[model samples]
Target: MAATKKARQPAELEMIGGKSKRQRIWEVIRAQRDGLTCYALSRRSGVDDCTTKTYMQALERGGFIEQSNETVRIGDEKQYRLIKDNGLEAPRLTKDGQPVTQGRSQEQMWRTMRILGSDFNYQELAGLASTSEVTVSPAAARDYLKHLAHAGYVTVVAKGKGRGAGGVPNRYRFNLGRYTGPRPPMVQRTKSIYDPNVGKVVWQEEVSDDDL
Candidate 1:
């Protein structure tokens, strides 16, 4: 009997622009119309979970990708999508050409400040941050507020006695005018999934962890 030849599998996608691992990941995300969870993306891109997460954080800080508020059922991983088309490229930079990054606590504080308006105390801000799924302690919130105040992003509006006698807490307001930094990109609520058979994206769904 003649020997049979085995079929060869297709080669994996190559990275473009001699880009770094993170950049390659971003390219993969850019190609997908539907957002992907960290796990799904890692599996498809052949990147490990830890590296994927690190790059994801960097991309998020650069306003290249936005993390959905929802989580996947398999591992509670958050979905990520490229920021909507605004002519701005990924790896967003600050005015001084610095990479824009924010810690989770700082992000929560900033978001709370923006949503709750300029008039709020650290306690209120902390509560709002917690409700928004970013847990922040009151002390930590106060520290973040102080840092913002020093950076001119926030201003002390008032001071009041704390819950305990002789204790004082400062009320701060967001200085929107002074803030000229890059803001988080607006995200779409739903995305379209590509169907290989049809050669086009045919289905749209609310960004969630549920099976498609």
Candidate 2:
């Protein structure tokens, strides 16, 4: 009988714990105090010229950047200078320069955890971490706690009573000693824990043959 070929897992690209193309472009512009043209930004950041222009347009509208008065030939791409510096974290904006709402909860929860020095239940965490703008549901809090607990970033003070006659949610305490940075340790879809502050995947679950 012929032997069967074994299945292989597809590798993840620069999707996990890596900066976005816009972020890379922003960093390049920030480093170039003199300024850089759209073409130059695209070349240095390894992003396509067209995509760079689109992001630059949004950045210009958001007032994060402005045109630099550098000499250029007729019809040459515009030179840009960083104006409102937002620091290391990339500004998440829509193509139209509108702010995006995707990662707000992650930031809110991480900041709240840093301030709460005592153990708390997931319900309490959700309530406290949430704001009028960004509402963190209990489910979201529970999931975050689960992943962090597995990664040793959070200590489970007590297990929860399931949604039974007298259900009580799990109580957990953040392990400050394990705190990597201000950025939250993200639970990636790849079954991994990515620490943006450290810019690395601190933990990942082992893949099984059955999953291949």
Question: Highest lDDT: which candidate?
Answer: 2
Give the range of the ten consecutive residues with the poorest summed lDDT in model 2: 8-17
What is the C-alpha lDDT profile of model 1 across 1-212, one tens digit per residue?
Answer: 99999653211112223233454565568778356677877877777788677777766666666777564577476877777533423453443334654345665666667766658888888888875445778887876676556445678899767566467788888887754433311111233322222223233444556754
Q: What are the lDDT scores of the predictions, listed in order?
A: 0.59, 0.80
Clashing pairs in 2: none
Q: Write the per-residue lDDT of candidate 2 for residues 1-212, one digit (tens) a residue.
A: 99999653222244334566777887887898456688888889988898789998888888888889767789886677888888987677888888888878878888898889899988898999999888998888888888988889889998888685489878899899888887777777789887766677777999899999
Q: Would you estimate the TM-scores of all the predictions?
A: 0.41, 0.80
- Top model number, TM-score: 2
Candidate RMSDs in order:
20.3, 6.4
